[model samples]
Target: KSKVSVIETWLRKHRLLYVGATRHPFIHSIRDGSVDVSSFKRWLEQDYIFVRAFVPFVATVLLKAWKESFDATDMDVILSGMASLNDEFAWFNKEASKWGVSLTNVAPQKANLDYCRFLESLMSSEVEYTVAITAFWAIETVYQDSFAHCLEDGSNTPEELRDTCQRWGNDGFGQYCHALQSIAEHHLEKASDDVRKRTEAAVLDVLEYEVAFWNMSQGDT
Candidate 1:
């Protein structure tokens, strides 16, 4: 309870992701329900494109679990997440309709493209399992904490978007982040110093990209 895990503690000390998470105006807008429909539509559409690219990154993670030393339970959890993404996609489309945004014609913005490229590079077979999984855990935990914070008792998040916030911020997803943290810490325990360094460096890059992503969402970048 003191910390989500050693990795989470390390990430906290890193502080880069925390800055990225809390500094984004889009996040503040979400907390205050001040985000306009157009901005939300931009995010929803571009994220749909990002998610399309994200699917393969996740698929690569699944392959890593199979080929690496990860257990069956790990695979089960990943597969379950994979299955839910279909529903997540459908949700985006539904939300897009509500806002009159067209996901089909949308393109990934510069920040999103850069992040996707990083994710694609991770698919290289030469990357170690520990490093790959750490990236996974970092990205997921960022979203979990970012959105979950919006649901804090006084968040004042808009009624219409509360469910969207809950998609990642819910208690269930917090447990999921804890599980991912456990996995990342488990691997870090056995990781060589070089791998640990690489993991931390990759996490820094992720944080930067996340900030860029939020900037893009707010049309600031």
Candidate 2:
């Protein structure tokens, strides 16, 4: 039998936190078709800010992969992610216009500021590739899982929000996230014990930040 990967083991050990991040009340509301428009607007505005900060962090990871990864395809995967941000920003702008949420006037909430700061912290040259990729994977997977859940069978997700849901919940995004997971696992398998421990900690941190991000969306912060 194949050995369980480091991320798989961590997921099993921290299932509760993982569940909390992906199945938060904010997501539940969307799945149930009871989501508040105000909450959605708030989320749209704040997430745009988060994504803006996310771009540079992803760039840093791409640079790390280019310099440190043994595999050539790793840079391609990271670069594809970076390229998608252009479409992502466009979607955010359209959504903001639809929701009447002026993106220009939206201030970063405490949760968003804290989360962006965390991403900035990871961009330091001192951080190892193993730890950075672990974080990059965790961050994407949380959105992929949470948004995909809203598209699951029997979910009562509203028609108006279906496009938003499909943006991350679609099969293509799922496949992309899986590719990221594979790259993370590959590096993690060879990581030294100290770096592995740091990667595990980074995964946990990502989960906490995701949960807080959803909470901020719901105005629960």
Candidate 3:
């Protein structure tokens, strides 16, 4: 796509979250040739990756359900802003529909103490909250494509289809798992070693199980 097309599409997907006041300091900077498109694109790309990686991890670890919807916070609004831009994203909606899956919600749940502790630790600080919220925005916008799909030629049976969906979901969950690990690592300079190690293990366990689950599918058929 042309740069204009890309920009237009991005705008459509994220216009809702854009600061609209032309007189705003940031807006003025951008309009006055200070902030450039490259800088803006960098931020957009980082937010996209963070959300894609973390959202599912939060859902699986915290919510325990694969197909959950998140609350419409500013994060959700940002995601909607980016998704509004192009017809290509419609394919994601269709693919998800095939398995009747959606993004997981970020609400409280009684999964496990370790999981709860990890989440609480992240949210306890305002800095971590900002990181997580930015990550969530990217996920709300574009993380559905990380997982692989079953062959579309109908060579697989319904049972195979279910297994494929499970495997794919696990793959997506693994990305989220990595996000947790990355965040813990990023914050470790401030956290105790014991706390850091424990948190890292908790996140790694989730990712490890997901890898095992996906690999196990290979042996099934």
Question: Local distance difference test, per candidate?
Answer: 0.80, 0.93, 0.34
- State, as a TM-score between 0 and 1, how close model 3 is to the true structure: 0.27
Worst 10 residues of 2 by lDDT: 97-106
Best-to-worst lDDT order: 2, 1, 3
Per-residue lDDT over 1-221 for candidate 2, one digit per residue giving the tens place of the 0 to 100 score: 98898889999999999999999999999999999998998889899999999999999999999889979899999988988888999999898778777889678999999999999999999999889988999999999999999999999999999999999999988998999999999998888999999999999999999999999999899
Arrange candidates by TM-score, descending.
2, 1, 3
What are the clashing pairs of model 2? none
Report residue 187 deviation for candidate 2 (angstroms).
0.5
Error of 2 at 145 (Å): 0.4
Top candidate when judged by lDDT against the true structure: 2
User: Model 3, range 60-146, lDDT digits (tens) per residue?
Assistant: 323311122233233333343334323323534454455454423322222223333443444433323323433332332222222
Model 1 off-target regions past 4 Å? 1-5
What lDDT is reached at residue 200 by model 2? 94
In Å, residue 117's CA in model 2 sits off its true spot by 0.5
